[model samples]
Target: MIRTIPKPKKSKRHFLWLLGMKLMISSLLIFFFMSSCTKEGTISLNNTNDNIGAEIADSITVRTATYQLDPLPANGKGIMLVGEMTDEATGNLKASSYFRIGNSAISSVTLPDDAVFDSISLALPYQGYYYGDTSLTQSFTLHQVTEEIKLIDESNAWEEDEKPVFGSGSTLFTNNTFRYDTNPLGAISFKPKPTSKTDTVFVKLNQMFGEDLWTKVKSGSNQVTNSEEFLEYIKGFVLIPSGKTPALTAFPTDSILMNIYYSYTRTADGKKVQENLQMKVDDTTHQFNSLQIDRSQSLLSALKPDAEGELSSDQTKQQVMLQGLSGLVTKIQFPYLHEFVNRNDVIINKAELTIETPPSSHTPYTAPSTLNIMLADEHGVPKSLLTASYETTTQAAYLVNDLSGGTRNSTYTFNLTEYVSNYRGAMEDTKSSLYLTIPVSDLLTKADRLLIAKSDDSLPIKLRILYTKY
Candidate 1:
């Protein structure tokens, strides 16, 4: 509820140790939320105050209230590579995905004039960066994406809770367990010379598929000439893990491709030699890693959305959940702004939100370096704080830093002054909500999440609003 303050004073970073929050405002909802709110009710509003420059004798009212919000909508997968990983610490989350691969035009132009097919292998250059324990063995299995490896971005089907079905997908490649160890799989990865660190991981595919590919190449088929034609013959590959390991993020098919090894006979002066040939990845085609996340075992899985769009207290009493890829965002609303409207014009000098990381009793995870937020829209789309930089962090809604947290307060704080200012500007029209999340900005389509404290905890989520009423 909106607590009253007598008079006001101020406040004010680019430091890291991210503390996060997000939201927007509309007048109508603000009234409904902020009305009937009272804290101690000690500071009295002046009886004669309808004027512009009314003297505000009392100290500034600082009120804190927490609002529950529905989960955020899924983000469109824009990254290039297929990022798959399961984190036991992060709700037993697992990512299963598939994508189409095409032969590079350069290599596809024509097979060796006198070439014969040998063996085929799928090469995936590891991006080198992984979220969980890379040292641990992560078993992976690749299947033939027999069905068209369609991109889900073209339709709204991806928005649903369940992932899109590759539809009767078939595995051309036999299901084999490829184990990922400290020295992950790659031709160059495990070289004895080991002059440089290996960044690529290779998985040899079924030889018959390569034979089929070579068959088509010998027929002078268009499949060898263009990716569009090649995809028709063999759609793509569906990647899944044998057992759950934290995560394995791979590069795009551009860096990752199916190399069809072949050999040609050459007679050099009286000696015969075997020469090698390869069919590389068509860098033009874009392969995506669409993630289907399983959150049943994670901390946030306990949270179930209520029918009426309300968050369950028991389900989310003490923790703020930021599930990655699966799109679970913490929604927060300021429900006491109407109390400020009832009195008169109040200048919200600074309204900062501080969310503390629940200190771990057993083991503590690394704090997210940067927390991000965006305005929550009723239509399931993202809205902004309506500020100069709502879309970017240049003028973000929330951030946690030592500067704001007194350099030692392990909590993060955000200036909600803009939110309050908009509310006062359009009293009856002010209504909006904030969606909190972990930012994903990679072709690997990978990011870690935050699971901090909520309002019901001993150290409840706080919104400290400093306002001066004139």
Candidate 2:
């Protein structure tokens, strides 16, 4: 036999309703006080409380992981990056730029018999872009490509969102490389002056190499007469940096020129006249930077080049990383979010995320000026970029500078109110994680990187939420 209990009387029910009202009023006051202390922004609500509750929480659990992105398309971007560096964050890193050279002026070129070839040199103009230590002297060698600088045709290489804005065509990626002669044509060592617009570094080629090309032009060889044959003979050029460089530098592809100098006797006056021929970089579409990153000596060693996987922040010393130029990106997730989903009593008002950098993380390198946050699938592939409220533009988190001596003051923050509200109503399977990456415009041209501390008490990442319960 079981005993049944009777329902409460009307007076008692009324008393409980009054009690809930009191609790709601108290919670509202607490929430308001906390919000005022934060001084970030104001929270407003109706003056009357009708059986409703409010909550302010900053203890939400956030998970973080890091993974490598696919090879980035590096062709026709107007910038050529070349360098080599070794650091604990990215391990041994190397960058090389490959591009073909051609000149239409050579089509009608004729040389006199008395003309004598002078020295030939390659002129590289800097674009004021650099990473790592510029105080040290940087050294690199110019090599001749043994094979043609050709691109492989891939019909389905780019996804809809990953397609380049410049239009679609066969392009080269950071992982693509061409065979180059082991012997370099020329090499140079100099202190970098990236910010000087008028400064140009010139590397003189071997006399034999210059004379061979000079002789060909004088004899009107087929190799020097047509673009097709010219490319077949000279192939292309690759800028390879010595392993000793601690910085990566960028040069404008269009400004690169190969100059051939010569002197000829004037038939009428017998005066010696000097002249030079210029060969500009050809087919900007086929130019690309080949990047190689070795993580064997760093925390990311577990990430294999041939495998797709992610390493948790716990496994990486409670930190996640985001790097440009096909390097790495961080993923963020809320594991216990399901506990509050679909709750009829709760109404999420605002959600803000803050990610901080570790101490000394900015010593030798500066963090990216801005970062883009995107919704990502389980495999870490970006699905859609998170956008501003009621706007079609993608949202970006700008880095806040630190005035104090401490490096931890620098941070990246995001407004995730819309996402939080949607997550509360969406099905568990449809919910996605957030990915923090460098801006798309910087991926193939810049080597900016960021290191974010994982979420924890007194740590680098935090999420705060203001909500109401009814």
TM-score of candidate 1 on Cα atoms, chains taken together: 0.65
Local accuracy by lDDT, each model: 0.46, 0.78
lDDT of 1 at 108: 43
Q: What's the CA error at residue 173 for candidate 1, in Å?
A: 25
Residue 168 lDDT, candidate 1, scale 0-100: 16
lDDT of 1 at 457: 26
Residue 158, candidate 2: C-alpha displacement in angstroms = 5.0
Segments in model 2 whose C-alpha atoms lie over 4 Å from true places:
1-54, 156-168, 267-269, 338-341, 454-457
Please list the Cα RMSD from the true structure of every candidate, rounded to 1 decimal place.
14.8, 7.4
Clashing pairs in 2: none
Residue-wise C-alpha lDDT for candidate 1, range 189-233, written one tens digit per residue:
221111224655667766766688778777767776666777777
Candidate 1, superposed: residue stretches over 4 Å from native: 1-90, 106-108, 111-114, 151-197, 226-228, 267-286, 297-299, 302-310, 359-365, 385-409, 428-431, 440-444, 454-460
What TM-score does prediction 2 earn? 0.85
Worst 10 residues of 1 by lDDT: 167-176
